[model samples]
Target: HTGNEWGTENRAELCFPQLFNTSCKKPTTPLSQVLLFHILMPSMSLLTVTLNLLVIIAVSHFRQLHTPTNILLLSLAAADFLIGLLFMPGEILRNTVCWFLGQLTCSLYNYISFVVTSASVGDMVLISVDRYVAICDPLHYPTRITERRVKVCVCLCWLCSVFYCYMIVRDDLSQPGKHNSCFGECIIFVEFIAGFVDLVLSFIIPVTVIVFLYMRVFVVAVSQARAMRSQVTAVTLQLSVTLTAKKSELKAARTLGVLVLVFLICFCPYYIVSLFGDEFLNSASASIVFYFFLLNSCLNPLIYAMFYPWFRKAVKLIMTLQILNASTYK
Candidate 1:
């Protein structure tokens, strides 16, 4: 028996140390021990979750802020919010003890996990596609990215995610006492299908499109950089030649490139681990990695606030309005 068979199959059944004892077999406890780790992990999760909720509610309540891009952001917030609320808390509970809830709760947990995860993946893909259109086809973007089209796209994304998760949830529900065992295993085929879909839809498709789009973006950037450099060089030939345009364009391109690169760097490891089924096969590391991926949701709002001018302004405006309203009432 594994050292961590302390929980129900449908829920986690052990504490963090017990669950991960095997992974840290060589380690001796430090002064603080696992206490610090536990506190920090849950705190981070809560912080990210609360911020995401604030952003989502703030955006939803403001009609002037709604747009095609914001719609995708709202969808992403919804997915991330559910992930933090429904999934993470249950997982934490499971890890610390036996499954307090029965099969019904277990099924709901699994279903919500599947749905939110799928939706998050779909939102990433949509954002990538949206960026490609905005950057590559600026002139036609207004016509292509209609509000109705975005709504349809968001709806389809949810539908596909729900349908994808349904099979797994249904399969689990079909077999009574199937999850009664002391493991989190679902039907093997269901696991297989979920894994395959995750690989294809989340890892494979999004990465492919993002890579291709960024490649084009780079080429265009280089071409534009060269043109600017050439013009600067010509002017410099007549003057001191100290000032440069190539360097500035290069800086902007590099900044955008780095942002995209950071996203991939942060996310790629989890997906790579995901591709190997064994990583998540009743392993405690899977839970940790799952939370690591969820960190991206928190990172998303930061990304938008930093990189997207409109989002930054919107956030600022909302905050300003709230402060004024509070002051006025006071």
Candidate 2:
């Protein structure tokens, strides 16, 4: 009777009954929860992929859309695109089923996740700086923020992200599954020292820069808007063009402000959870917060669509396959 009871328990609990003693137990979630995740995760993944792809195509295919600012946006869209394509699906599978891809694959997945996320954060900082210069120093903006310089910055951002993430997860890369106690479990734990360093580099520093730059940008933008409104004179061609340019800059600042604000809203919770300890990392609440982080990649493109008429027009062109024409870029 004891043998039968033991067998039943193993059959019910173990992810692999054949390796019962070595395998991790399957997570026992309510049927309703499983159903909810199935519906929610896949939908988020699909939307993230689709929306970021549109941004990529819109920026890349249109000649008129290629500017220093859009180049920064292109880099951002590329990082978000990778997040949707690679990380989101892996996360959904990890939560929904057993880890069957083995330890090396798991380590690689974690490495790529870190690289893409870091790149996205770096891109946000660049965008903030771009807007800062455009709004705060409009006379020098053309010389200061050129496409060639922006391209160089974008390249450096990606290269640094790769190097930084490798440094963070170097131990996991060297010895995959060292932290896992069972065959079906895939886990990576950054020691407290490493986690603290990551918190400083990844969260604390970037958030500080973004907030500071955008705060300055907000003050300058508001003042510029008021100046533009109050300085109305006879509509000479030069004055008309100047007012139009100021209005455009103000609108751009407001849109990118929304992007940065949404990023903070989504990102802060996950890092705050990380601050508590490694124990919180594996909890169900942490999983939910992690999804919130991933949700930012989806929100970005939607923000673009809402704010940018060019993005809407570009989407229409791409959807109709009009971009395939050689003259579309012209």
Candidate 3:
């Protein structure tokens, strides 16, 4: 909301200086910060797109990798891929400079961002439930979480994401850029009540499900470890087994530590700020926070795909061109 008077004749400083009081003044973002973002964000986006692409390819191309869990990962990786491919570059432009793209683009941007983010969240909940069932109810896991069921659930997740985000951004779509206080700035303001409901339904409820399921999975895993420990016969053998088991438990604890830390670090601030109002969403600092939240999408492949040995093998095959050669020979 800074004045064009301070901006002088600098069209660079004000998005549209000729409009005077109505023009959106660019935030006093430092050159170094903007330059750094210009360099880093695209690189992050490229890496995210590449890694997630590999995950998608690996899952799709290999028969051995076509499991229920991999299907969910593939769905999540696609969501991440879209974020990297579409949203990150757009955010770099929209946040780092004046948005010259106009209101229609802005509306579409917000809508797609919401849909992708919602799908990503839904995929996370699915992954958690998958793990919970696999670990806590191993016998039923095969029957309960078949590939057909996972595919159907994935399709439903995307469909629901599209429908739900439409509900959130419908008003803005009906009247393009209604929330923008000044020309050239892009902002989407959900009604406070609508935003609150979105917070509850899209974020809070799903995150609670993920956390609870993971906690339950953790408990089941621990109980299984104890059961294994109890099965050891000799005292010395039990001592050795106990030490190895303790090490494994410690490793699992560290992984869970990373999971909780990443979840809280990536998600909490964005939603916490959202809960207050879109006023914060309009601020420059909050744009940075929004970018930080988007960062979780980039990290997701690492968290979900990198842990699996099959993924590693798949990557190796793809990278070495073995898969291509195999296809050619076939």
Worst 10 residues of 2 by lDDT: 28-37
TM-score pick, better of 2 and 3: 2
For 165-284, candidate 2 gives per-residue lDDT tens digits of 999999999999998888876665787888899999999999999999999999998888888878786578998899999999999999999999999999999999999887787666
Query: For residues 1-330, could you state the per-residue lDDT of candidate 1 as single tens digits?
Result: 454454343123232234443211222224442542367557766866876776686567666557677787788888877776766666555554445465566776777777887787777677666666655565587899988899899999999988877875576756633644333322122466666776776668877887887787677666765656666545446333322333433443454455456557767877777666743633465555556666676676676566656555556656677733432221
Model 2 residue runs over 4 Å out of place are: 1-5, 30-32
Give candidate 1's whole-model lDDT.
0.62
Q: List the residue pairs that clash in candidate 3.
A: none
- lDDT tens digits, residues 62-166, model 3? 877787877987898899899999988887877677888999899999899999989988887887777777777776877999999999999999999999999
Off by over 4 Å in 3: 1-22, 26-28, 232-261, 304-306, 326-330
Compare the candidates by lDDT and give the number of the best one. Answer: 2
**Candidate 3 structure lDDT:** 0.79
* Better model by TM-score: candidate 1 vs candidate 3: 3
* TM-scores, each model vs. reference: 0.71, 0.95, 0.84
User: What's the lDDT for all of these models?
Assistant: 0.62, 0.88, 0.79
Residue 170 of model 3 has an lDDT of 94
